[model samples]
Target: MDRIKFGTDGWRAVIAKDYTIDAVAKVAYATALWLTRKFKNPAAVIGYDCRFGGEMFMEAVAKILASKGIRVYIPEQFVTTPMVSLAVKKLKANCGIMISACNGPVNFNGYKLKGDHGGPMFEKDVKDIENLISEENEIDLELLNWNYMLEQGLIQYINLETIYMKEVRDNLSPEKFKASGLRIAFDAMFGSGQNLIKKLFPDEVSMHCVVNPSFHGVPPDPVRKNLNELSEWITHTRDIALGIALDGDADCVTLFDEKGNLIDANMILLLLIHYLAGYRQEEGKVVAGFSSTGKVRKICDHYAVPLIQSKIGFKEISRIMTEETVLVAGEESGGIALGDHLPERDGFWAGLMVALAIVDTGKSLKQLLKEVYSITGPFAFERVDLELNRIIRTRVIENCRNEVYQNFGSFKVIRTESLDGCKFYFSENQWLLIRPSGTEPLIRLYAEAETSDITLAIIEAARKTLVGEA
Candidate 1:
């Protein structure tokens, strides 16, 4: 049996190679065992996105959990990761499982486990479940007929989307947003979040909602490059206030300002913090990923709120939010959570909050960014993904470890941080972060500076250094 390993988020494998029914059975069986040991009558909520084979994988997972005498609650149709997490909390289930790989490529699928707190499972618990996976625990995947389980009261169909929509309506004021007179567009990227924004803001929102498992041959990530079409439309349109995009399973989001300028996650995180603290007069600790910009600390200091820099991953930020009084928590990947909302990352919820900020403040997204810049100062950030072979990747890591060069291009390294990646600081406000991807054979190079030109230069210089070009 192939060992299924969990990444920073979940266990993702390419379809047909390793992500087969047998492998899923092992993980599902392991999860079932863990649930049985934790609760006397374990109950779980299961869901899937609009990915290929989502139904099949979800059914397999449901059957395995039901066979173990664990009752399962599943959505009647496709749903997002947040929906499953919300279901766990609302339904009082012991755990939650989502079968869509959040933002992965078209040929990939995954399994995400959520705790009863409406967030990711604890890292320690996930490790324990991984340790429990073995051939002995694997059971007959079809031990109980799915329909028979349904008839026997083991499998219960749920309207998770309906339940989740109610929560959204309760938390966000779509009526206020509609009355604000600012038009907005949402591009679902053909992921599971399709048609949801329209349902939320029928009169105020323009939508590009569709269901395509292949993602129209593009990865369903809400990054700048993957969102050119949406950006172009927002740029050419006259009255559009901004554009929003959701990833494959709708756990993450990226935005474009009124002028169609890409507002990456760093800017969004800062905006969220400023809105909550400065506009809403909220008070609590702020949490951000290490990969996030230093502006987070600047804004937090300005607001007199505490701040903690977590390792890269929503799971880390989510865990801290549950334990602390977090006003806002976010990572560089666009998965943001607010203190007033559920602990889990909800792109839909985040978008609504952004809209509310624009409405209440009566400011454009660009103007709100300017407000944040008054504290953190003007800065630009960029990332480059270097696809290198194993040998080159190892050599690059060794070189970074040894401090091979005194500087990257002309930028001098004033300091270096090895929290989760090798962050070479050119100055207090300028730095380059080099980190190996946890799931792929690639190294990511991140740079930030006071200007976009400098940011681009730093990335180019770093790339040249890595490839021995200069």
Candidate 2:
């Protein structure tokens, strides 16, 4: 087998391929060894999502950890990524494991590790676990009898969804949500978010809340292209005032306005910051991924809140959220974590907060966004993913590094920044970022300008300049 490696957040591979039983066992054994060293009496909260073989993989992880003499707590049913993270803190476990790939394609499955503080494992801890993967053979892969192990008090199954539901109830204002009288359409994308969101808001309309491992053949990501079903449903339904969709593991979300217009994460992040800082009077540092809109800086500056930019991924932003007083931490993607909540991303929390923000202000999403743009000003953003041949991708990166291109069509390269990716600045607010995907053979081009048309134009120009037209 190839060397087991982890990506930005976790280790994911095509199911029945690199993500086979032996692969999971390797990860589990490495985790067990790492946890044993970290805790005197190590325990873990293990859970799985709606992916194929979730339960079987969860059992495999449990068996491996139990064989190592570490106790395990698992959910009675499939749970979201945030639920597992919350369980780690609530159960006081040394760490947490999730059998999910977040929003990866249907054929993919993954493993995500969580720290004791209820967030993604610290970067150092993740490295330690990765190092241990190479020495997985050091762990004794003994198969402890399942029932016998349970009798010995090594495996415990608890209603993790109940605890997570209670946590959600305690954190969000249900009364405000009910009082708003606004119709909401939720699409779970056939992932783990199905049950809880339906139970949490039974009065609301929802879709794709069933156990479909295939995710209806569409990728389980909550992005615009993947969320066509929800968008169409909401747009056709006149009474639905909002549309919310969750990714596979339910840690991230995408929202749509009353008219079914896709509200990107940048606007959502800006709106959340505005609500917390302007309306709720909250204060602290704001941590955002490098791909987030520059408008975040404007919003933070407007509120006198310091803004810190990290490399893309919730793990990077979440690491800082755990150490500092973070008012809000989010990525350009839909993953966002609020202050006074678990440092980990919570789709339910983010959706509820957005709902509550609308209720508190007694305004529509468009109005709330207008309020945000009043401060941050209007900015348009777009991300273009290019799936090119390896040679072409490498050459593009080489050109970007060497500064071979002085202009992109009409947009000149006025400045260049390489904080995380190669960023070519056209003006102060207009820029383009070319970043390669860490886990996949794709180059992502991000463009931000004054309008959506300009953003798309810039991206297209960069694409032509880099890889040329097909």
Give the winner by lDDT.
Answer: 2
Residues 337-377 of candidate 1 have per-residue lDDT tens digits of 88777778888788878888999999999999989999999
Residue pairs that clash (backbone atoms under 3 angstroms), model 1:
none
lDDT of 2 by residue, 1-470 (tens): 67887777798899998888878988898899899998898999999999999999999899989988899998888999999998899989989999999888899999999999999888889989998885345444454588887898899989889988888788797767877788889999999999976787898888899999998888888888888878888878877767889999999889998878888778888989999999999989999999889899998989999999998877788888877999988888788898788899888788888998888888888898889888977789998889998888888888888888789999999889876778899998899999888666789999999988889999999988877733
TM for candidate 1 is 0.96
Candidate 2: C-alpha RMSD after superposition: 1.8
Query: What is the clash count of model 1?
Result: 0
My TM-score estimates for the predictions, one after another, are: 0.96, 0.96
Candidate 2, overall lDDT? Answer: 0.87
**Whole-model lDDT per candidate:** 0.86, 0.87
Model 2 reaches what TM-score against the true structure?
A: 0.96
Q: Alpha-carbon error at 154 in model 1, in Å?
A: 0.9
* CA lDDT, candidate 2, residue 217: 88
